[model samples]
Every structure is written in C-alpha cells, then in structure tokens.
Target: MEDPAQRRVDYGDRSFDEADLAACPLEQFQRWYSAAVDSGEPEPNAMTLATAGPDGPSARTVLLKGVDARGFVLYTNQRSRKARAIAHEPRVALLLVWHGTHRQVAVRGRAEVLPRAETEAYFASRPYGSRIGAWASEQSEPIASAAGLHEREAQLRRRFPDTGSPGDVPAPPHWGGYLVRAVEVEFWQGRTSRLHDRLVLLSRDGSPAALDDGAAWRLERRQP
Candidate 1:
C-alpha cells in the first residue's frame, strides 16, 4: 500500500565535473547554500545532525546557527540527548537536502563545545523568555506534565523580571553552542536516467591544508 509518488527521489544521471567545484569546499558549500536560500526553501537552515550515542547512532533535525571554515555551529541545552551524545563522542555528520534543486550535502566532522563566554554572549542575545526557559527546563529529562514546565517557567520569570535589555538576561550554564570541524564534505546532484553525480572532499589528516592541495579530495561517481 505504498504510493510511488511518495517515494524518495533518486538522484541519478547528474553530471558533475570536479573541476567545476570551487577549490575550497567551504566556498562550494556557501554557493550551494545561497542557492537554496534564493530558491525560497522553507527553513533552509534546517539540517539533519547525526550523533553517536552509547546505545548506537541517532539523528535529529536542528537549525544551523552559523557556519565557517572551522565547522558549523548550533546552539542547544548542554543536558539534551544530542549534547550528551556529542560529549561522549565528538564525531558527527550533518546532511542538508534541497529537494527543489535535487541537491544534497553531507558533512562528517568532529564536534567541540564552544567557550563558556561565547555561549553566554549568544544566550544573552536571545529573548528574555528563552533565557528563562533555559533556566527552567531540564532538557531530556522526563517531565511530570506540561503544567509543571509552565510553573517552573513562571517561577523563573518572577525571580528575574525582564528589564528590557540584554544585561537583564543572563546565560544559563546549561546552554551553549557546539562547533563541528568537518573532515569530509560530499556534494550530490541529481541527474537524469538514474545517473547521479557525487563529489567528495576528504582530508587525509583532518587538516585544512589537505583541502588546499589539488590531490586532497578524491572525487568519484556513486551508483544511484
């Protein structure tokens, strides 16, 4: 009872010339990301984050707060399940898909917790209610009920009335950011006749210099 129309689109027969790609993977990513934004894709910043846990591997969607040559940045509660997984195993992978363009980007990297000061600065930039929620909720922990959460939030609001300024909102110690340093970045483009194009950029020693060398990324075609 499956609908053929609902099946996942298979990207095949796409033509990709490695030479057409930018010398730097970051530049290429930026180009594709900009295209996605221009296409008016909803929540273009949404990416699937994969993390390894004690039990196994898990994946979840999170908004990308920032990106740079070093890695992609995302903010979350330190005590969340994904944060705990990252704490144990810093390695991670991210997947971004823009169905309209039939393009996908996969990134494998190592995650690192940003400095407390940086986390504080970002937290302070958020709305006062969000800051209070950070202090009120014990993320990933089982809650008695939604009412209980509301009560805790109400107490926090009463304890710290917003003064209409960033100074009035303090960062909770449990909230921070994580940066993923990519070692492998793969770009996939869909094509006709099930012939897809895949280009992979992998660093030999997890160093940025490897990407600079022409021989660093071993491009190959994958079966659709």
Candidate 2:
C-alpha cells in the first residue's frame, strides 16, 4: 500500500482577508457559494452537519436546501439520529468544503425546526421519486436488506402513482427541515506551505444575530 503520509497537496496562492469579506457573514457566504457554483463544483451546497447529544457528537453530510438572512437550511427525517441529537442539544455545527475552489465555510449555530409550511413547500418541490423514497425509508433505521427497503418503496409508489405531478405525494409527517441560526461563520482559503487564510465572523453578543445586521457581527483573522 502507498504511504498515506506521502500524499501532499500544495493548495495554491488564494488569500482571504477581512477586506475581502462581505458586509456580514451570510453575505460573504453567498459570495463564496456563488464562486463555488461558477467554478463547476459538484454539489457545492452539500455540507457536513454535526450535532451532539447525551450519547456524544455525530456528523453526516446533508444537502443544503436554502439560505437567507436567517441562516442555512437542510431537510431530514425528524426521527433521525441528527434530529434526536438536536432535540437533546440544539447547538450544532456545519462545514461546507469546496475542494475544487480550495475553500471552506464553517458555521456554529442553533438548529430550529422549520415551520410546517416551509417544509411542505420544499417537499412539494422534490422529485417524484424522492418524495416516494422519503416516505418509504425510515431514515437512520436498520433494515434487513436493500430489497426490503425497495419493497417498501414499491408500496409507496403504488399508493402515490407518480404521474409527474408535484401534488401527488404529500410530505411525510416525520420529514422536515431545520434552519441553522449561526452565531459564528468562518471562511477559509487554501494557500501554500499548509498556511491557510482563515477569517471568522462572530456575533458580537455571542448570540444568533440577524445575518444582515452588520453591527451585530465582528470579523477576525485567525493564525493558520
């Protein structure tokens, strides 16, 4: 086997300074997000979500569904491990890595359950197959076999009969979304010699302040 330690990547000369940041963290995030998309980064909105509970911390990758002045949003099963963890401890962290762009964004925040209306609207926007799968599989649950899961999906497909209509399948009661109200957002840019650029935006009062409130946040650079 090749030596893993021998693998090296000299991340180019990109630099991120305070002046490069937007008025607020969310704005800065949008700029970076757009750059990642324009760079042809596949699944640029995918992010690692971390939550802690009595058992400990757990993390998984989830696709970002939306973002606004409130923060980032993602959907999942309400009964999943991550959701249970959020119930125990609302505080969570998110990391979005854009390998193609040699950049990353980290967020520390509180996860709040999205309103049913929002969840329903987003769910309705999902592909017909995805809608069926959402109801068929119990996320994070053990199953005897993939066949069994497919069988369950088959049953839902029979019930919903996908006619390419968004209203055909309604959102499952347990399937919903969460909005991460960020207290701190950090942007990182890769540079040579393992010395990266890290600029962090923090809520002045250490709370989840409005993302657009320029006075509510302060930016700081960290040693990299």
Candidate 3:
C-alpha cells in the first residue's frame, strides 16, 4: 500500500484579464465554452453538479443542456436524489473543467425548476431512446436486478414504437429541467509554477436578474 505516482506538470502562462472580460458573465462563459469545443475537448458540455441535503453533500456529473442570458440549464428526473436535495436546499454548485486547455469554471448558484413549456420543448428534442429512458428508469431508485431494469425499458419501447420521431414519445411526468442562476462564478486559468489566475464575479442579490443585468454583478480577481 502506497501513494499514487507523484508527477507534476507545469502549466502554461495564459491569463484571464479583467479588462477583456465580457460585460456579462454568461457572455464570458460562451467565449470559453466555444474554445473548449473548438479544441475538441471530450464532452465539452459535461459539468459536475454538487448538491446538499440535511445529511451532507452529494456530487454527480450531468451534461450541460443549454445556456442563455438567464443561466445554465440541465435536465433530470424530478425524483432524482439531486432534485430531492435541491428541493430541501435550493443552493447548489457547478464545476466545468477543460483540462486540455488548462481552464476550469466553478459556479455557485440557486437551482430552480424550469417552466413546464421549456422542459417540454427540451424533452421533445432528445433522442427517442433517451426519451423512453425518462419513463423507464425511476432515477435514484433502487431496482431488484438488471433484468428488472431492462424489463421496464421493454415496456416503454412497446408504448412508443417509433424511435425516429421522438416527438411522439411523451415527456415523462417526473422528468424536467433546472436552471442554475449563478450567485457567484469563478474562472481559473492555469499558469506556470503552480500560480493560477482566478477571476470571480458576484451577483448583487444572488438572483437571475442580478446575474443577467451586467451592472448588478461585482467582478474581482482572487489570489491563487
């Protein structure tokens, strides 16, 4: 029994200057997000979602479904452990990593369920199998066996035979979306000698209004 390999890799000298920051944090996020995508980063939209309940903290990775003037969007089952935790405590955190580009973003925010119409539109756009999965798997729920899970999938398939036209697959009653309106956001860029660049933006009232208006957020640099 021993520690893992100890190898240190020196980072690049990239910098994130306050002068070049976008008027709104969402705009800045779009720029960095596009960079990650153009660099061919694997699953560039994947994000780590952290939630807390009365018991303790929980974390899981979920794909970034969308982003707009308001905030970051992701879809999940309403009965999920994360959703339950969010109901108990609406505060949550999100982390996005672009290791190949030596960049990362951490966001502390409050999660809110999206409007039903918005969720329906997003759900209708998903692949047919994924739409079926929304109905088949009671996310975060224990099952007796693998066969049992497959059985549920089989039932869903029979209910919706056309896999090409996902629109025909009704959105599950318990599946929808959440918008994380950032209260605070930090962007980190790796630099040489372990010194990194950290820039943070804070919303005045920790609400979407403060997040999107540009003038309501205070921006500052943090020591690495």
User: lDDT of each prediction vs. the true structure?
Assistant: 0.82, 0.92, 0.88
Top lDDT hit: 2
Best by TM-score: 2
List the candidate numbers ranked by TM-score, top first.
2, 3, 1
lDDT of 3 by residue, 1-224 (tens): 54557767777788778887888888888889999999899899999999997778999999999888778899999999999999999999999999888899999988999999999998988888888888999899899999999998998889888757757798988899999988898888899987898999988766645444689788889999
RMSD to truth, every model: 2.7, 0.9, 1.7
Residue 198, candidate 3: alpha-carbon lDDT:
92
Off by over 4 Å in 1: 1-15, 206-220
Could you tell me every candidate's TM-score relative to the true structure?
Answer: 0.87, 0.98, 0.94
Candidate 3 Cα outliers beyond 4 Å, as residue runs: 1-5, 206-210
Task: Report the C-alpha lDDT of model 2 over 96-189, residue by residue, as the tens digit.
Answer: 9999889999999999999999999999999998999899988898999999999999989999998878899999999999999999998999
Model 3's TM-score against the true structure = 0.94
Worst 10 residues of 1 by lDDT: 207-216
